[model samples]
Target: MSPDQAQAQGRLHDTDPVGIIDIGSNSVRLVVYERLTRSPTVLFNEKVLAGLGRGVGVTNRLADDSVERALAALRRFRFLATQAGAETLYVLATAAAREAENGPDFIREVQKITGAKVEVLSGRDEAERSAYGIISGIWRANGIAGDLGGGSLELVDVRGEEIGDGRTYPLGGLRLQDAAEDSVRKAEKIAADALDGCSLLDGGAGRAFYAIGGTWRSLARLYMFETGYPLKVMHHFAIPAGEALDFCRKVAREDLAGFEHIDVISRSRRALLPYGAAVMEQIIRRAQPTEVVMSALGVREGHLYKLLSKKERARDPLIAASEELAILRSRSPRHAGELADWTGRLFEVLEVEESADERRLRTAACLLADIGWRAHPDYRGEQSLNIIAHAAFIGIDHPGRAYLALANFYRHVGLIEEELSPWIRKLATTRLMERARILGSAFRVAYLISAAMPGVMPKTTVRRRNGELVLELPKDIADLDGERLRKRFSQLGRLMELSADVEIA
Candidate 1:
């Protein structure tokens, strides 16, 4: 491989894109991420449900039909990987391949066809990856990291940050349903043996069972639908422990027609819902977590995390990445530079006590604050939201950072959405909202001041006057556009709970 290609495939730290193809019993997926010093951009992502393990458990071999379907998908993935400029292909195979007789031959054929070697993961490796995925996304929990795949289930004990004592069982939904009841029980016992006396999980007893994998996520979606959660946010939605158990109970007894209401749940998964629910219920009973935090960040993010840490160091990778992207795509780099300098100076003069990351995110917001000018002048707010919402920004998480960016952009165009309130609420703390609002309002003032004469700097500083924030304009500024500036300042002052005034000779 060339140096550039080598770097792209090497690791996320190398500031190049990387591709990962995960071959599981139910589906085949390929993801290409453009990794930067702080963030990762998803260049391409798609999945196909090959059901590679549909009948592998009973047959003890991958069916000829399944092999053909998987091979075709792999070929398509190869094309996409190359198109994405991905230098390396990391292929991980789960249960079906590990248990099937023809699995080895299939992997070899794939290597010949796509020149991408497939690594058939042991149940342990699969469990480890699942644990890593959970840890990298959510807070480290003292409990079992469970991932239920189509053909098998793996559980790993995670204590603090370390995940150890993993075991893979053949009693996955598909496999368990295929086997005799006695065999299923036997498989459960074998799985139970792996966690027989692990201490890490002892702490989790009566706490939450941090649920990971498609099965539990499907359940969470069902719960969200039932509860009427406005947004389909998965990363931080905490389903009460009792609610999760109740949902499991409902799924365990519900018939096929019952799941039709869930927009994302498929008919194919209907048969497995009861079994998957049962698996979760059992785990929940064993290593109880405080609540089930549906992890939106998992294996893919785990791989990305491993890659990013290998890159340059940053206090918060997520924040750093967002800042980098904002700077890279900023349309007015020069204006953004000026805005940041002025904003920094203003904050310093005001004695703001926010952390570096908070300051950085604000600076980033100012940089991309004017990107909407590229879109139609009338609907720049809508255009700005779309750009930040869907941009393939290297190293930034979608929604979270995008919301912060949009909040700033909307200030320039006037806020008009009830929908954005939920997103603003997801910022973990209300203080974040307050900060964004203050910065956003300030940006609006700066934008208006700059709109009249692009580079004209305000002569006076902003300060608390009586009960309002008032801008003290320079004599020349007051003479040129004093009234216009005063009106703007009064509007902002009232909105931000302050007063406005200007002193001119």
Candidate 2:
């Protein structure tokens, strides 16, 4: 059967390690992933700024120093990938390699030294692949995906799995800076002129503009720092077009002072921040995207994503990640799955009309609830809170991040006399906040009844009759019940505005 057919039939097992090396205009990066699951986790990630695109506009060739530095970096990367047990390696060279005069010679040397064939991506290839990465990373995304590198920019209209109308421009940070003679206004005009020719992008108004690249990521970091946005996760961080345009204009002129978290950004990355902002400004103004969302996945991720079968791509990334975490940390993966289904009974008794999204989040919470057992008993809640809140999970936004984190936190610690961090509280709406507390309290009650053991949770039943919420503990485990269980049951009851009653069969 074909890979897609195998995946759809649930016959593919992608446990073998894969490696990708992305050689771009500004930096060379190596990423080793544990497996090619729905939410592939990075086992090792490192990058070096070789500035291969530096002066490429003027020299028509990769810089000599940059080439030497990049070669050295590649040697290290090859060795590291081998040591990491990567079964196969894919080396991708972007704009600098494709546009420079000596690009072929540089590729030959890289092949000889690294023993990996180099694939130079055309502008259209880069744009389309980047759009795929965005699609794989987000649940439902439609807009223009703009990938800014040091040497070139790739723009494409993207909607779900479909990619179309791609175009490449010399509006990359390095290339634009040279073309505009380091003048922001000149750069703006050039960007506008280049963008104007793309009639394909005329309808982007009020839609998303997904920003993908290092310099743009830095800009997002600066924005997060300045705004003091609590959730520091970058994958789905979004800003209104108007607000983003103002910030871009300010950063385009090198006025990035007073951002509290500016120091966290690298000096080399900070230098190109303006060029990134400048290009973004024109795109937002002309394209009129309602919002600018920063995407953490780009070309390398796109390559990996493309290799996945359609069936695998259809799996929910959140569930895949939660299941993996359960296997790695929880007592039994079966118990986690049991907890997930048992919680539905608890919510049903509460008369909560959970939306589809809420149901998904609750299931995720169940899978992840017991993963924090390895941490100190005293701090499992906090540790789980931090890890879930900041995990590299896709298909969930910042608010949902808080919801999962808080749900797991509650699972560890009962809701009474406990509070979430202020930043986390801000991420969840009041309704979601209440739901999290309810889920957490219910989790505590279930944990008490099940003792975190497998096959026990399935016997727990929650029912509401005559306007009273009733929790029934199986007769076999009646001895395990205690005041803590009753109190947690009561807490869950009050959360849903019902009187708590537990029956020990």
Candidate 3:
């Protein structure tokens, strides 16, 4: 059987050491997983239809009863997770929580009660994780996979099971219902345009379509019922495109009664089946895949799989990737490397002692500091911000971390855009800011060092001197640039409230 079949049939290994609690629009679910001798295995999985999305479209707040029920479920899952000895309890809140007014507050409450700090994911995160899961689990070869949920529909590009960059459109069934007609048309245009723009589908002339989520499953079920697909299983079943399109068109024109023959689609979901199927039809028309498969695993499984992977647990993936990317993509790797070496040396004497881990992250920050130049010299800084914001690096948690890293990269040019200043304050702690500052300072000095390199310059050391501070450099190094290095350190010292003096060695 195919991976999709195995997953749907619960035939694959189920031992999982990680636990994930997914607070979604329609329900709250928790899964505990451990690694078996075989593939990652699921230990326990349970779902409760808390309907956190109920009334959210109109009220813009999670219903009180829904929140209570959801929290109760989480409170129980907390025990199960702990009982299973889960070290990393990855808690994620989807559309329901992200759009609610008191979402952050409720998240804090859950953390306090369950000891699970929830990472309320944006729709993009939802799409990205789902995409990764599809790649890692079912379609490891190459194809486009999509997960259409009650809250949102996520589109992904896949190379077999390997995931590539994908985009998310906010055209979920619930959201589509709330959106204006013009808005719906605009969203369709945007989704199609984005899909067409992506290069992942370039070589996917006629690949299988791996579908996941309730909407797709429902559509596939309706097809199975109508076509009298011998078995009820949809994992590897082929729903022909013509019949699939026809079924969708028929459903689109029918009332709720037209779906009575299909029992798999619940009464609650019957009304939205037409719209959801319309989305399916839209993508299928564009993709023109040879066949379609359904996925039973998505975000929860993806979260578990990711945590088990060597990248997230054994080492930091982003730092590792950044180091390699820096060397491969930098305009002047040699110069950049030399400047980084000098910067490290200068930083040692500069009073702030960073840990090995901090230094590693800093090195990564330094290496990719020039990546922005790839886009355009004039807007390199902006490009840097975008790369950090969207790149699928190993260790990043949210866009804020990327923003923090990118902001430091821009500081290499000697100016911080004031508009981003508030975000820096809001997002970063004092320690994080200091690290960013050190990285910025190191890069700036490195740039100057490269310019004066292959020529005799000064040796420098920075340290705390008599409660104040001073950077002492060899006379030749200090004199070559005429206090250029000293002035920069002095500015940094002042900004960080440390009085600094530049003394000739």
Candidate 4:
């Protein structure tokens, strides 16, 4: 059924779907998202590096070849988006589309080929939107955001919802590369000179430098491989200023082709790497940010964020996505809510010191605990793991992602001999890993008693007594006190390193 119709019938899909076209200087791309939330998940994505800005710097016009390629991509994008059941397609044209002399003509052609609404963003407009993307995604970011596109660069100061004035410069990668004639030193000089007037650099000191755009993400990926970083998720990936400066300097000075993990660099993106680095080097020197935190969201997400109400923007993306999944797939949504609160009490009784983030993950796990109930009994754990691992979840980092997957996996199937891969182990800490095991054990006990049906969990009372964890079942629900339930309760106690006692009252 269509997603809208399904939702109306109280059968929600795992995700909401929307589409956007990013028309930039270097490429024109189409991104279809699973939903529009603080954390968006991509359902389908395609990009064509049309080099629309290649000659614009010198000739002040869009190249004929690039124009044709962009238009062709747009035509295909409309059909693909429609077939994907996207409710809206937001076409955002950045620097090149608004800067080049022939930009207007190109936009007209695009509008004709694809009858979707188009937005041509000025540099300031792009900067503000980029800030909104970061603000909406991160918990509470207080930093200077720099988004490097092919045609222009945007810098803005953002803290929560109070966004400072955003400015746009012509120091974008492709534009700077052309102006510097491929000289790394010259590119550095141009970048430094451009930032001389940006007062936002001063406020960024000791704060984060939230890097946006694809080039920064690619750079983060390279850094991840080089360091053997345990978690490879790019969003919220942080690097100290000193380390980032060193990396950028090397990229600016040498060819990445000679470096290790160079294979990660795409051909279309390689030549522009040095230019991106040059921009970074200047931003680092001027801002002296405490760290550089990479953001996967940008102008497109910013546009989406703008459309959201204050209440929707306030909801944690991870929690909202988890709750939505449960409502759609779980037999009883009320049970998920009950499990979350039950686990909270369990944690408090055990005196577990779960940080805010840990608590959030634990609550989400409870909501998603029964996602694989319909799967084959023998493979439900594996099925649930695979689904949650790659699901359209955002906000949670890769390590945290592993924690969620493992917790849900063991929730159904016991922690077997060696189902977890080495990579998964590396994704979380010893503490986080143990929490998963404990949460899984608790889920085991809860399910063995309630069978995941509603009303029974709330009737059960769990409390910590003199050197033991006691579970008191109501006399009315005494039918749940089966041998398997007893065994599972004791197993949970063993996992928690305490004796478990169950009694009917």
lDDT at 125, model 1: 78
lDDT of 4 by residue, 281-362 (tens): 8899998999999988889888899988899888888898788889878877899999998888888887778999899999
User: Of 2 and 3, which scores higher on TM-score?
Assistant: 2
Off by over 4 Å in 3: 1-17, 34-38, 54-59, 82-88, 180-205, 309-505
Q: In candidate 2, what are the lDDT values of residues 21-101, reduced to their tens digit?
A: 999998999998877777878878999999999888998989899999999999999999887767689999999999899
C-alpha RMSD of candidate 2 = 4.5
Tell me the number of clashing residue pairs for each predicted model: 13, 0, 22, 1
TM-score of each: 0.76, 0.93, 0.52, 0.90
| Candidate with better TM-score, 1 vs 3 | 1
lDDT of 1 by residue, 234-267 (tens): 6556777777877886776666365656656876
lDDT tens digits by residue: candidate 3, 455-500: 3222455567765566666756655454676677666676657787
Ranking by TM-score: 2, 4, 1, 3
RMSD of 3: 20.8
- How far does residue 179 in candidate 4 sit from its true spot (Å)? 0.8
> Which runs in model 1 stand beyond 4 Å of their true positions?
1-16, 35-38, 55-59, 135-145, 155-171, 180-200, 205-211, 233-237, 309-315, 324-329, 333-368, 382-406, 413-435, 450-481, 502-505
TM-score of 3: 0.52
TM-score of 1: 0.76
Instruction: Tell me the lDDT of candidate 1.
Output: 0.65
